[model samples]
Target: MYGTAAHNTYAQNNVGIESPTRLIEMLYEGVLRFNAQAKKSIKDGDIEKKVYWINRSIAIITELLITLDKTQGDISLYLEGLYNYEITLLTNASVDGDVAKIDEVSNVFKGLLEAWRESTNVA
Candidate 1:
């Protein structure tokens, strides 16, 4: 409980200090991490762990979808579709224990993360 509270406080502080672009990058990183854990859990035959990680990935994607600016026109729409697709893929991976599905979603997130990093001129 203490560790969880400390972690939450750390996360809150980081979020408070981060720029918008950095926050988005962090979100992508988080989804990637969750997907990796989900894949590993599936490999280890740990269904509960797999579900937990995949659900986390899905939640992040959903958050991204919710926060999209509709005024951005085609870009926002495209992102919404992509995020929804990722959520679907993650849900399927959780249900079917499909490592390949997790891999696919992770690869998509990797590409997005790299693109975001390049756009933000972040190392």
Candidate 2:
């Protein structure tokens, strides 16, 4: 546990060591978090905040795709393909107002993150 924490701390300190897979996983998690916040904001009657999270979620997916392409030529390409599918799902979820899709994406990303952490020895 300490080792994992230490590795996470190390990764936080050194962004250079972050892989595309890690970035995509982080973005996936962020989408869930931000969307939840957006939902709350909507419930609280704040249209702006709702839009904020929606836009943020979209931005994260967009950036993930671009970053994946830029980070190409390693294990990144495979990861990119996986995320591309996730991104498509996310896009559909956004359009269809399907909260369940987010959960599905979250599950898929959790698996991806686990594999990435094991292979890279990252936390």
Candidate 3:
């Protein structure tokens, strides 16, 4: 409980202090980190941890999907499809214990993270 509270506080602080672009980059980084954990959990035969991490990744993706500005036109539409595909891959990986599926999602996010950093000049 203390750990979670501390982590939440840290995240809240970041939200308050960080630029919006940096926050999005952090979210992408988070998904990749969670995907790595989920993949490791599958390899270790730890079903509970696998599901937990995969669910975390899915939640982040869902948040990103929902927060997208559809008013941006084609980019938002493209991202909606891409994020949905990532969520589907994460869900399937959770059920099938397929590390490759996790890898697929990770690959996408890594590219997105780099692109985000470059485009946003975040860092």
Query: What are the RMSD figures for all models against the true structure?
Result: 0.8, 7.5, 1.0
Residue-by-residue lDDT tens digits, candidate 3, 25-57: 989999999999998999999999999999999
Model 3: per-residue Cα lDDT at residue 40: 92
Write the residue-wise lDDT of candidate 2 on 3-29 in tens digits. 999998887876567666666567667
Which consecutive 10 residues in model 2 have the weakest lDDT in total? 93-102
TM-scores of all models? Answer: 0.97, 0.56, 0.95
On TM-score, the candidate that comes out on top is 1
Across 1-123, the per-residue lDDT of candidate 1 in tens digits comes to 999999999999989999998899999999999988998999999999999999999999999999999999999999999999989888888889999999999999999999998888986
TM-score of model 2 vs. true structure: 0.56
Q: Pick the candidate with the highest lDDT.
A: 3
Better of 1 and 2 by TM-score: 1
- In model 3, which runs have C-alpha deviations exceeding 4 angstroms? none
Off by over 4 Å in 1: none
What overall lDDT goes with each candidate model?
0.93, 0.69, 0.94
RMSD of 2: 7.5
Residue 22, candidate 3: Cα error in Å is 0.6
Candidate ranking under lDDT, highest first, comes to: 3, 1, 2
